[model samples]
Target: MTESYLLGIDVGGTSIKMAIFSNDGDLMEKWSIATNKEKDGEYILEDISVSVKEKWQEMDLQANQFIGAGVGVPGFVDIEHGTIDFAVNIGWRDYPISSILSQHLGLPVVVDNDANLAAAGEYWRGAGVDAEDLILLTLGTGVGGGIIVKGDILHGVAGMAGEIGHVTMIPEAGSPCNCGKSGCLETVASATGMVRMARETIEHNTNSRLYQIWQENGEITTKDIFACAENNDTEAVTIINNAMYYLGLATANIANVLNPEKIVIGGGVSGAGEDLLRPLRFYYDTYALPKVKEHSTFAVAELGNDAGVAGAAWAAKTKAK
Candidate 1:
C-alpha cells in the first residue's frame, strides 16, 4: 500500500507556490514557479497541472496515492462551480480552475480565494490554530483578508465576504483604490497605500528622516516607513499611526459582528511584529464594542508565505474527508 498525500497550490500574481503534504498534514515538499500571465493567463492552469505531474514523478509516488488537490487563487472565486469570477492580477475572468485541474490531475480539486485560504491555514496550523473562529488580514501590496466562523469560511451571498480591504475609510478627500473606489481601507492601510501616504507627506516635510532615506534609496517602502518609525522619525510615526487607525477601524467592525477568538495579521507589513501589533491593538480596542474588545485577541500570523499552501492543503484534506 502506498502512502497518501495532498497537493496544495497557491496562485499569486507573480508566482505559483505548490506543496505536497502527508495525509496527516505534515509538509513533505514545496516549490514555486513563475506565473505565465501571457495570453490572458490561459496557460496558468496547464502549467500547474504539468508541474504537479512532474513533482509526482520526481517523488516516485503512485497516481492513486494523492487523495486530492486544493488551490488558492487571487480573485473572487465561486466555490460552487470552482470558477474564478475575476482576478485582475492574473487576467482571469470566469476561469474554470477547479474543473480543469481536477481533469488534468485525476483528483478532486477545491478552489477558493487566496486570502480565504490564508485564513484557513492560520486557523488550522498557524497563529489561530485551535480557535473555532478567526480572521486573517494580509497587509501587503494590497490589503486582503478572510473570515472564518465556527471552522468554516464565511462566503457571503456574492462570495465576496471578508473583503475588509474595500471597507470605506475616508469617504471624502481620500485616495483612490484599485477597486475603483475612493477612501477604501486599502488606500491607506496597504503597503502601496502607505507608500503613497509617505510620498505625500515628504512633499511638505522634507526635513524628516524619512525624506532623507527616500532621497538616498530613491524609493520608499512599507518596510522603510516602519523602520524609520521605530527610530522615532516624526513623519514615519505619523504615517504609520494614520494607517493603523483605518486598519483598526475595519478590523474592529468585523470583530463586532463575528466576535472571533483570534485576529491574525499577516503579509510583509506584519513583519514589524510588536511595533505593528501594539498600536493596531490600541486602535482596535478603541473602536471595537465592549464584548468584542474583551473576547478577541490579536496575533501576528505565523505561516507567512506558506499560509496559502498550507491552507490549500487543509482544504483538500477536508474536502476529501
Candidate 2:
C-alpha cells in the first residue's frame, strides 16, 4: 500500500522546522531553515511552501501522498478563523496563515500556537505519553506553555489559555515583562530572568564562585548557574533556587486547579536536568497541596527540537478526521 504523509511545520522566531511523517506519526525526514522575517514576515509562508515542495520532490513523493499540513505559530492564534490574532515578534496581525499556506501547498492546513503544539507533542510521543492530562512548560529565552485536558489542547475561549509565562508571580514593583506586565513568572523562571538575577546578586556574593565566574566572563548563563549551584556555589544556588521557586509556585497553583498527571519541562534551561529539577521539586512540594504534589509527577521533555514538528504532524492527522 502506498503510504500517506503529513507535513509538519514549526515556525519559530529564529528558524522554521519542517518534517515529513507517516500518518501514524513516524518521522520520515526533517530539516530546518532560517526564518526570514523581512518585510513584516511576508516571506515566511512562501519560504515554507517552497521548501516543502522541494523536499517532497527530493523524496520522490507526489502531492496526493500528503493528507494535510499542520503549522505551529509562536503567537496568539484565532483557531476558529485560521488566522494569527497578533504576533509581535513576527509582526503579524489579522493574518490568514492557514488559508495562505493551504493555497500554496494544495493541501488542507491546520494551525495552532507553537507552545500548545509542543505540549501536545509531548503528550503524544514524549514524556507525557501515558497521561491523559498534562502541562508542558518550555523555558527558553522566554517561557511558554500548553495545557492538555483529557487529551485535547485547551485553548480556552480566546485561544490564550496556556500563557503560563505571563502569570503574575510578583504584583508589586516587580520587573517589567514583554507582555507589559510586572512580575510575570517569565520574569523569574526564564533564562532571561535567571541571568538577570545572577547579575543582580553577583555583587553581593563577590567572594563566591558565581561572582568569580561573572568577573571572568562578564556574564553568566543558566547553565553556569546550575553547574555552580551543583558544586555548592552560594550565589548560583540562590539564583537557581529563587527562579525555580517562582516556577514551582506557578505550576503548583495551576496544578492545584488542574491536577494534571504529569508536568513536562523542556527548553534550553531544562538541559540542566537534575540540577534544575531538584530545587524546582522542592519548591513545588512547598507550594502545592499535599495530594496534588503527591499525585502529579514532573518530567523532562524527550523530543528536543523534534517536538513542535511531531505535535504539528499529530494536529494534521486530527484535521484529517
Candidate 3:
C-alpha cells in the first residue's frame, strides 16, 4: 500500500512556502519561492502549480498518493466561499482562490487567513500542543492574531474572528492604521510600530544611543532599536517597554474574553527573546484578571516560519478525518 500525503502552501506577501506531509503529520519535504504579488492572481497560481508538480515529479510520486492541498493566504478570506476578500500588501481583492486552484490542480483545496493557520499549527504541533485553548500573536510588520478554542480555529460569523491587531489600545495616540483607526494595537506593538516609536524617541531624546545608530544607518529600524536594547540603551529599552505595555493590555483583554491556556508570540521581533517576553509577561500579569492569568502562560512560538505550512497540512488532514 502506498502512503497518503498532504500538500500545504503558505502564501505570504514576500514568499510562498510549500510542504508535503504524511498522513501521520510528519513533514516529508518543503521549499519556498518568492511571490510576485504585482502579477495577476492567475499568474501566481500558475507558478505554484508548476512548482508543486515539479516537486511531485522529483519525488517519483504518483498524484493518487496525494490527499489534498491546503493554503494559508495573507488576506481577509471567506473560508466557506474560498475567496480572498482583500490582501492590501499583495493588492489582491476578491480573488476566487479555491475555484481557480482546484481547476488547475484537480484536487480539493482549503483556504484561510495565514495567521489563523499559524495559530492552528502551534495549537496542533507547537507550543500549544498540550493545551485545549490558545492564542497566537505574530509581531511582524503588523501584529496578527489567531484564536484557537477547544482544539479548533474559531471562525466567527464573517470568518474574521481573530483580528486582534485592530483592537483599540489607545483612544487618541499614535498614527492611524490602515484600518483607519488611531492608536490601534498594531500601530503601537508591531515591528513597524516599534520603529515609529523609536523614531519619535530619537527626535525627542538626543542623548540616546539609538540616535547615534540611526544617524549611522541613515534611518532607524526595528533591528537597530532591538540591538540598542540588547546593549542596555535606556531609550531603546523604554521604547520596547512602551510597546510591551500595549501588547500586555491587548493580551489581558483577550484573556478576559477567551481565557486561553497559552498565548504564543512569534515573528521576527520575538527573536529578542527575554528582552521582549519578560516585559510582555509583566504587563499581561498586571492587567489580566488574576484568575485568567493563573490559567494562561506566555511562550515563544516553536515552529517559526514553518507554522503556516505545517498548519495548512494539519488542517487538510483534519478535514479529511
Best by lDDT: 1
At residue 210, what lDDT does model 3 achieve?
82
Judged by lDDT relative to the true structure, which candidate is superior, 1 or 3?
A: 1
lDDT of 3 at 206: 75
Candidate 2: clashing pairs of residues: none
Model 3 regions lying over 4 Å from their true place: 1-3
TM-score of each: 0.96, 0.96, 0.95
**Cα lDDT tens digits for candidate 1, 42-137:** 999999989989988998975588878999998889998899999989999998988888888888899999999999999988999988899999
Per-residue lDDT over 67-163 for candidate 2, one digit per residue giving the tens place of the 0 to 100 score: 8888999999998878998887787889999999888998888999999999988988899996889999999889999999999899999999999
Whole-structure CA lDDT of model 3: 0.87
The alpha-carbon lDDT assigned to residue 10 of candidate 3 equals: 95
Clashes of each: 0, 0, 0
RMSD to truth, every model: 1.4, 1.4, 1.6
What value does the lDDT take at residue 75 in candidate 2? 92
Ranking by lDDT: 1, 2, 3
Give candidate 1 regions above 4 Å deviation. none
